[model samples]
Target: MKKSMTMMLLLLVAMFCNAQMQDPVKFTAQLKTGNTAEGEIVFSGKIQKGWHVYSTNLGSDGPIEASFHVDKKDGVELVGKLTPRGKEISEMDPMFGMKLRYFEHSVQFVQKVKFTKPTYSIKCYLEFGACNEEMCMPPTQVELNKQGKSPAVDGEAAKEEEAKEEAVAITDTAAVAVTDSAAAAAPAALDTAEVKKLWTPVIDELNDYDQPVSNSLFYIFLAGIVGGLVALFTPCVWPIIPMTVSFFLKRNKSRKKAIREAIIYGVSIVVIYVALGLVVSMLFGASALNALSTNAVFNIAFCLMLVVFAASFFGAFEITLPSSWSNKMDQKSEETSGLLSIFLMAFTLSLVSFSCTGPIIGFLLVAVASEGSIVAPTIGMLGFAIALAVPFALFAMFPTLLKSAPKSGGWMNVLKVTLGFVELAFALKFLSVADLAYGWHILDRETFLALWIALFTLLGLYLLGLFNFPHDDEGRRTNVPQFFLALASLAFAFYMIPGLWGAPLKAVSAFAPPMNTQDFNLYKNEVHPRFTDYEAGMAAARLEGKPVMVDFTGFGCVNCRKMEAAVWTDAKVADLLNQKYVLISLFVDDKTPLPEQIEVTDTDGSKRTLRTVGDKWSYLQRYKFGSNTQPMYILIDNEGKPLTGSRSYDEDISEYMDFLNAGLDAYANR
Candidate 1:
């Protein structure tokens, strides 16, 4: 009962965190001309059911005054009085002691501006507060453009309006010009242009949100083909050919009967694997796809599982079932179980080749799940199983090719060793996740690169027959495949050498530390070129006097790719960010170092250097929040108050606007 209760509670919490609960708020803007020929800007906030927006007219006590600032343009002037549409009365707020006046459903403010020309345009930054009866969010800013045209009065009225326009224009022009200049000048202190430009990849990420679901499905098919090809080379399926052909020949009196049974074997293999996939899809709802990709716990667990599989590949142990299990399955085959016999045979094959296939299956599961679909694993597995099963059936029908198969001795051992290197290399990915989540600086760029170099160096030595393992072949003959694999491993090691010095390494940019996060970066060495660090980024937030966006990401995280490709690309989301946000992206896998003097004693009380950019940010992630996963978006006030309940992503794009708006709402209220 206790276990059940715990499971239920966990399920409920997961549901709440992943909930699509928030509704969007609407606000309207209108433009009008004053006698000055410049436009008078009137902004209105329209709240939905159970929502409220605060008034700007409080005596320095209300939520930050519904403020507006005009971008400076020559000859355009804005002189406006902003008054809230609702009644004014003082109410106490928890954070601020000032008595505040607020509108429950909506509020509108009008500001007056002046223009020297008959027509002019102005961009206004309208910052305001919003709340419901229960909670107030942080303050938010909305950018709006208001345009105006002069009235067309022919005779007597034209001169009078023209005189009024000139008078208002003279008074408003100076104030607008000064405010605009200051706003433009502030970004220079921290390299605003360079930072915003570096963030162009965000636009590409946003575009992914709108991509068709079919494209992902196509990728699933491609992965299936790759899995099938890989299965063809494994020892388990390759050796099965002669045994199957000889068995069919012995059982059937005629050649045609033997061919018919072989076809049934292949058909049975495809059917069993596809059915297994469908069952997996049914058992785990598609919604789990999101959590599987972005949840920190899930990523860590998966990484550990891969490590275990890697050890198995390295010949530490074999994964196998009981001998009686295969005996029982084989007995069913002799009982003429037909399709069931074929499935039993496939199951037997899986068990027989457990050592070789285990690592492959684990790798496939992680890869497909990272695609952000519940069906991904099932599809990947089905593809792989079918591939493994097909060759047996094919070789049964054509017995002559068995003569050409490579005679097994040291060759299989070499293949196993090659796969061992790949398994170990891939295991680092999960460790990267744990490092990002736990704030371990040990896995930073230089450290990660150095480890890969050593791992590959050892692998190269092993391949050249200089280093012999317990299972290695005693004979010395380097085949072309072995030579090629060794060369590739060595070349890859060479490739990573320059990354220690902060090279861009653009060819594998997605997998390497972002250039901005490198400490001694060589390629693009401009200082403060863009939003490189959290302190300067927070400073930008302070200047805007708005909420801050903390984006926790990593170089090795796969789900980060899916989120960037799918959810961040939506047009509504794009507009919201371009207009309202101060975006800060912190790569948790970055290897850049921190200042030598700055250090924090972790919960375990170990003395550790803040060696890498990822280390510091990842530490912040864990200390601030319990989990460390990439594609974590935390919205907070400049004072670091949490907004929008913290968000993570996997597949759903529509919820992105909700997450953004929720943060904006929180800010507007705070």
Candidate 2:
């Protein structure tokens, strides 16, 4: 018993020693009120130990983040900015390599506060977590009221006190606790305060970011299969199946010879597609890949192109070049060396089916390019081309299978129309990105849902043979392929309907607006309750002395989607979001207008009213950051100071957490 007691005491002492082992960090924050009745807050964090803090480059799902809010009034605007002083550390995780910001000895995070009224004192809370090289502690929120005793001596001191209070209010226990029995019964609520206090600084550190790549690879592979299936229905590829089989049979005179030629043909197709991907990668380099994925201009262009492609698919007009171009290629193809003939044949088919294949190709390119890497687009295109080319190769291996393939007829046209609807539906996504970048309120959450509903409803009707365009046959029963795809489409449409009334479509959570933006939602509880509107968010920030994270994201932004699907799902990332940050999703494509009286001039000297949510956010993004990309996250200190060029998130969630933790650390010490 004596020995056991000695060991226990030693362990407790060691733990306490570890907790107190951290080097003292210095933090300073200031608050100021302006003529316009707004608030500005600033914070600077200084660390004595070699340990460094991260910048305000918070990810969707990451650690405890730095934030500020004003608890004194309503409609008081607060913005924030973080300046990081440190060296960058590069680390590789399973997903990607990323650079983290840290300091060895000392650094500072500054916060500025502003208000319409010249208030000199603020009562707020400061929340933070501490860690050494080996161990970490839970987060803690310090409730303190800061006031300069001699406001008349140094005006700056008064301002500084106010700012400190505003910064501290970020983690203030001022919120009225929900009294519902459900809140008490819920598992997450049991340790809410303790979790919030302990997790704040270490929020970014406690994450299971070690998911294997096999799942990601599998998802891509599955997408490839889906693309292949979609391609098989196109008129250009569908007719060729029968034609190739008959040609092989006639030329070979024997099954063996026919199979050999078919095999060669398939090999040529794969080579051609892969080469195309490589060539594109080589041409664009890394910068192009980055832009392809997130460039606002590119997204808008792609969106418009899809509209045109969809129109063609709907038989409004054929997007075809002169037949002479194909004839010339054919002649040249025949003259080329032996294997090149197969490539030429593949090229010929692509040209003949340009109208049918163009939209799919464009969609694939857009999806890949949004991953913000040079190799992403190339790999995506390779996947798509390979999927498309496989059928040709497979048919060559078993010409008999071609006999059972669906014949071309009215169903083909119906398929084209169906694809058109899909193309049109996806087009809005690009537009949404551009809208958000430019603040064009052309499509909000409600508007987007409404459009999707109409598009899918039409698709269901077309599938059931109740609706027909001039290009579609008026008489035809839905075939097996049509039946299945139509059913899937119909089911998807029905699924989205509930989302309009506030359903958490977790399966496609990555594809929709955040649950916060929905006016009506069913599954939301107190922990992650639905945000009523932008006004409510703004009002809360004014009242609580908390700064907001204006997330410039879009429904169709592929990178935005990828980040949601891949990065935010990490448990660490989710925890931070639920506890640390006040998330404000501003869809750039929302088509609502500010009052005409509220029209304002932008940095580019353009005058316009806030006609759309996208327009306002887009203008702010461009003028403020010179960037027009989806998944653009901006962290402002309570006084609206933009923390530009901080440590940001990419594919790696740890790095993202590093940014969040660093920002919070800076705020805590301040």
Clashes of each: 27, 87
lDDT of 2 by residue, 1-670 (tens): 0000010011100000101112244455544443333344445455545233434453433322343333343222334654444553433211111323344454444444443333345654333333322222122223334443333444565555545554432221111212232122223423444322211222122122221222332333344445556776887678877786676667667888777766777666666656766677788775576565445688788888889988988889988768998898778777885667766877777777676766676666665554434665456555666777777767777767877877887777886787788778778766765654444455655567778878887788788777678877656777776777678777777887876876544433434444434555554322232242333454455456555455656432334544554346555666665566666665644435533213444334433333344544444444343344455555544434443222222444455566556545544454
lDDT for position 558 in model 2: 35
lDDT of 2 at 115: 38
CA RMSD, predictions in order: 20.3, 19.2
Error of 1 at 284 (Å): 3.6
Q: For model 1, what is the error of residue 207's alpha carbon versus the real structure, in angstroms, after optimal superposition?
A: 11
| Top candidate (lDDT) | 1
Q: How would you encode candidate 1's per-residue C-alpha lDDT over 1-670 as one tens digit per residue? A: 0000010011111111221222224555555543334445666666664445667665443343576666545456656577567544345432242445666655677776666655455656565555442222223344455333444223234344434542111000000111121123234544544333322223222222332223445445556656566555656556666777788778889978877787787766677667656665667555564455445577678767767765665667776668888787777777766667766776666666666666676666665555445676677767676676666667777777677766556666666666666666656655654555444444666677778788887787778777766666676677787787678778878988988886544333334332333456554422111364665676778788767677776543334544553345444555566567777777665545544423444444433233446655654555454344455676666655566565665344344666778889878987
